[model samples]
Target: MTYSQERNKKMHSLLYKQRVLLEHTGKSSVFISNDSHKYYTNLLEYIEGDLERNIYTIPVLRKAIKTDSYEHLLKVVQFFSSNTSCLFDVKYCYELENMEYEDIQADEYTNYILYGTEPVTANGSEIEDFNPKYLSFYCIINMD
Candidate 1:
């Protein structure tokens, strides 16, 4: 399948379900109260001008972590699944050096790492990387 086709499939499959969406593109989902929109928007706009846009968005992303719980984060992704703005693409973060997918699937200790994504996990040879921004969250705002 073409890239777009696969992307569409992934979005369709995940968005409809009560799950989180993370892709190889390093885009992930995040949810925040409507009141927090301004703050998030400003941060995103500022980071857009930075050379290391992804790296700098870490602070914003961290704030999101505190704002949305693991379960709610997944729900947010589902809410914006069809939102073209919220691709819910995840950014690369850390990885489980020695942990296997099967091992961590049920491990409560690795809950943070498994917050988002289904078929895609820190399992296999995937290196977990920091997903600093909610690309999908941008969809909720008007991009000038």
Candidate 2:
């Protein structure tokens, strides 16, 4: 598929996950069984990189947050998606699980977190401060 088509597919999937899929589970952290994982993992095979540089990751998280947290994730993803950028560390990342590339032969994968934050705006006003961050996404990514 062309780049535009690829991007649009990712957009549709992200929107489904953000609005439909997760809503069904009714939880922030949803676990997928190994069997189910197999089905969905390849769905994003056309995606360029892992969640590390994935564009869909942050937007979903931003929309998930009720207010302040939304601003931070948006800003961070925007910067990290680029070559070099940061805005007062509006985002942060910690790998709850780690898998290596080589080890992935048997069981390994690339899961990198690039964090930074954006401003939470209210009526064109952006909130800038030390706001607590929350988990907005639990994605199954294949970092190619």
Candidate 3:
């Protein structure tokens, strides 16, 4: 299949998966919440950009991980680490597993990379730091 066809297929499959998740929540199928709709819309946009611009996006990375597309996944990781103001946390078990499965060296993965200069805060004065780089990663993994 051509690249465009592959991207369309991926988007359709993701939409179908989201529909199934919505069904499981016992919500009306027609009433997709604004947040969910926005998420899907952003996801489609990212996928299209990845295909057309030859750039890797977060959804692409997540799909690569899911399909065991290790090389592409690594490329995404590297791209986020170097090119974007994104930070990645390597704490999740699944992420660890992906790293191991792909035989990615620990050093190669940017360590404690912070995505933004401004500190992330919660509960006024309690500061939390998060890597913004993996925003795309989170979006893809959390896609219902």
Which candidate has the top score in TM-score? 1
Candidate 2 local distance difference test against the native: 0.33
Which parts of model 3 have CA positions greater than 4 angstroms off? 26-144
Off by over 4 Å in 1: 1-34, 55-60, 63-83, 86-88, 91-94, 97-144
Model 3 per-residue lDDT at 78: 40
Going through the candidates in the order shown, the clash numbers are: 16, 7, 2
When sorted by TM-score, best at the front, the candidate numbers are: 1, 3, 2
lDDT of 3 by residue, 69-129 (tens): 4444544344333322122233211122244212222322233233333322222231233
Candidate 2 TM-score over all chains jointly: 0.25
Candidate 2 — which residues are off by over 4 angstroms? 27-66, 69-144
Residue 30 error for model 3, in Å? Answer: 17
Q: Which of candidates 1 and 3 reaches a greater lDDT?
A: 3
lDDT of each: 0.36, 0.33, 0.37
List the candidates' TM-scores in order. Answer: 0.29, 0.25, 0.25
Order the candidate numbers by lDDT, best to worst: 3, 1, 2
Cα lDDT tens digits, model 1, 1-144, are 986566555544533332222221113334445544344443333433331322322335445434444454344333333354343343333333372122223232234445654223336443245242311222122211
